[model samples]
Target: MLSPGDTLSDFTLEGVDENGEINTFTLSELTDDAVAVLNVYVYDYSPVCTDQVCDISELEWLGINEDVNVVGISGDGPYSHQQFIEDNRIGYPLLCDTAEEIIEELGVLHEEKDGLRRVPQRSIFLIDSDRVVRWKWVAEDNWDEWDSGPIEALNDTISQIRA
Candidate 1:
């Protein structure tokens, strides 16, 4: 499992744009001068996931951090992600972790919840320009008591960390 100050492995995934066209997210690309907010979630249109994604744009202070690059990742394929983006008006790029390779590699896989397996645990990672994970949160369970989106808690932590 990754920890604070541990640099993450550079990984790329097939991403999708608002137009449903093929997009790509290479972690190395964002490490130059930005703190990337890795928004990892479950299915694309799942209720909690939908609310979380929709609420991201409301995080206006994201600009407070140096160049916030928000990327939403899930097991949903590119097509589904495209639809979700169009439906939810997600302003950020969404990566399709259909094979769960990245999820498993990061050890954030929420296994076998009610017979469903390979669900990407609702988690977030703040990868600063150094490519180091400066802050992270993995819900002990699903998003029930754990609000996994980029909430005030994360913003406060990031502000303090970067201050």
Candidate 2:
């Protein structure tokens, strides 16, 4: 499993930005001298996942320091992500992992969602400019929903990193 201090894998993915624009996002964009928060949610429209995604955006205090790129990833396609973003007024990039490729690579696949196993477990990774994952969190139960804890912790971690 990819753990803290481990470099994230390189991958190009289609995602919906805050403006609902479709764009190609490469992991290297976050690695090339940028701090990032990579959030993996199960589905786009689900209640818990929605809360998890939006929570990261609503935390304005985190922006009191350096900018941290907040990117959300899910098995949902770009279209679905766009709608989700519009519906919730989200202001971040939400990436698609429809093939579960990145989810599998991250080692956070829920493993029991589809017959072939594609759903991603609710998780978060705090990766630094060097691509090293500084912090990691994965839900213990697939059914459990995420609160502000992850993003709040992310905010705190960002503060520490920029300090």
lDDT of 2 by residue, 42-154 (tens): 98878888778788778785355345777899889888988898999887899988888888878898567457865788899988887788888898876676666766676
Candidate 1: tens digits of C-alpha lDDT, residues 1-163: 7778888888899998556678788988866677788888887878877877777745676445456788888888888887888887777789988888878766788676577655888888888877888888876666664353447777877677667
- RMSD vs true structure, all candidates: 2.3, 1.9
After superposition, which runs of candidate 1 have C-alpha atoms over 4 Å from their true positions? 18-20, 62-66, 114-116, 143-150
Question: lDDT per prediction?
Answer: 0.78, 0.82
Q: By lDDT, who's the top model here? A: 2
Q: List the residue pairs that clash in candidate 1.
A: none
Task: For each candidate, give its TM-score against the true structure.
Answer: 0.87, 0.90
The 10 consecutive residues of candidate 1 with the worst lDDT sum are 141-150
Tell me how far candidate 1 lies from the true structure as C-alpha RMSD in angstroms: 2.3
Clashing residue pairs found in predicted model 2: none
Angstrom error at residue 116, model 2: 5.9
